[model samples]
Target chain A: MHGDQVTDKNLCLALINQLKWDAVCLTSKILECDDDRLRQDYINILNRTFAEQKQAFDFAKQHGWYQPMLAEQTMIGQVQSDTQKMVNEIQQSMMTMHQQAQYQAMPQQQNLNMGQGMGAFQHYAMPAMGHQQQIYGGSPQQYYR
Target chain B: MPHAKGKITARELLDLQSHLMLESNLVGQFNHFARECTDPQLRQMCESFARSRMDSFQRLAQHTNISPIQ
Candidate 1:
């Protein structure tokens, strides 16, 4: 495509960075900018430039041009993290179920004695048949640890 | 037309970069003095020239992808 016809996200961000850099340099060159009015005037131009970009973004929402490269990358990363978390939960649940099956296959009397292992099953909702959580702090204080 | 007869030597190529560095130095000197200058108009004018030179130097550095002389 011709350069004029190609509206790329990199080109857009590069243009914005250049414009913002120039605006900052111009503002720095101003001498009496300490005056509130002058400062506000200069700031307004900078703000308007970003505001223009925002309007462009909104207009291009249908074309997906409005989705910033940073935002897109972040969303992809979040999805990966969520998928990993789901996979981990699945694995943990499977392990727990397997251990219960193994225990159930053992002498039924041992399952009755399972209540003594407070460090283990209390973490899960089933609580391994009966000791209370108040003994281990139910507040999820050890939740992260 | 501008005259160009001989091929420029590698040394000359290096010298050209050196000259650009000197030009950048001149810009810094002018800026240093401009900051100390008491006359508002002259100081502003001098500083603006320095700024333009710095911009030029930065453009050249960016174009060549080389460090300007320290």
Candidate 2:
């Protein structure tokens, strides 16, 4: 079949994909164990898992839900992680903005003495500001004159 | 060559094994094709009978911290 794409390759690849998705997690649990005997035992367990995978692939051909479920599961997990990251980033930005606003307001607050003034500027003026544009020793009359 | 960062993915390991198997088959198929293949380029393809075959099992074993099952 020169130039004719091998159809079996597609099926075989599909089988491999199914095997990886279905069994990889379970296999990893066994593979990750520290015990060598247990790891070998896990490898041995693959015979059943592989057979079951082939059987499931055949079943899924008619049911048609296998690959879609696997793909959807991964995407859903991805969306959740992405949304969590976005939320964290937004919160971080808000915190930074709040800090910056507090810093900017600190100098202004000190000059105005918002704490000591306590609504004094609303309807009343401070004695310091009331002292007009006279030098320290000059009287108000001399300044006005 | 760019090095990979992060734990070796199970899917990646499986894919590597799958590709190795495919290449081995291709090497076997090439012997016959070398005789029949009219294209000089295709005829020049190399054959490897488990000689240069690389398996992910060893690397996987190292990463997983276990003796290779193979």
Candidate 3:
């Protein structure tokens, strides 16, 4: 490639990098959004951006302008194992919390069952309301109803 | 279904504005690159990207109006 063409290719790569960054920022925004419609719109735009990014990447690669390095098998394995370990730790913590909540609610549930009968207690009891609030950052009513 | 029929929250408005800015910038960059590139294939790719970004920009811009929540 000529010097000017090389410069153009480098600029194209830079633009592609910008698109990748934009996609990341858009994804974060989507996660933060509360409105379903707005979130869907953002998701649609994100999908388009991803498709265009892929096209730009392929074009650069086809023209011998950009070549990404491949990760080694060992490095890939290490990342996979690390991710699995983190997931396991999160699961274990969640199970412990769930068990503790259930244990704390057992006495209250039993009292309600005995006083109001099993059917009424089942209808009115919200043993995990507090735990749900803690996790969801909202009132029990907002979640239950 | 109708578009933006529900009331737009402040957060959603901010997100839309941010996306509009990004899309506009992308459209400009892609159009510029398309014009500057000497290779036909690269030029076509850049033009295509510019068009897509422009479409996104228009779609996002349409949501800027505030409406009553249904």
Highest-scoring model, TM-score: 3
- Per-residue CA lDDT of model 2 for A112-143, tens digit only, reads 55534344452343456343322234666665
Error of 2 at A30 (Å): 58
lDDT of each: 0.51, 0.48, 0.78
TM-score of 3: 0.63
The runs of at least 3 residues in candidate 2 whose Cα sits more than 4 Å from the true structure, single-residue gaps closed, are: A1-71, A114-145, B1-70
Inter-residue clash pairs, candidate 1: none
What is candidate 1's TM-score against the reference?
0.26
DockQ agreement of candidate 2 with the native complex: 0.05
Interface RMSD of each: 22.3, 12.6, 2.0
Chain B TM-score, candidates in order = 0.64, 0.44, 0.81
Ranking by DockQ: 3, 2, 1
TM-score of chain B of 2: 0.44
Better of 1 and 2 by lDDT: 1
Query: Which candidate has the highest DockQ of all?
Result: 3
Task: Name the regions of candidate 3 deviating beyond 4 angstroms.
Answer: A1-6, A73-145, B1-6, B66-70
B1-70 per-residue lDDT for model 2 (tens digits): 1114454456555643454345345335435434553434323421221122223224334444445445
- What lDDT tens digits, residue by residue, belong to model 1 across residues B1-70? 1113344344433533553465466477657646654546435644654665565455434323455544
Model 3 chain B scores worst on lDDT over the 10 consecutive residues at B61-70
Q: Candidate 2 falls in which docking quality class?
A: incorrect
- lDDT score of model 1? 0.51
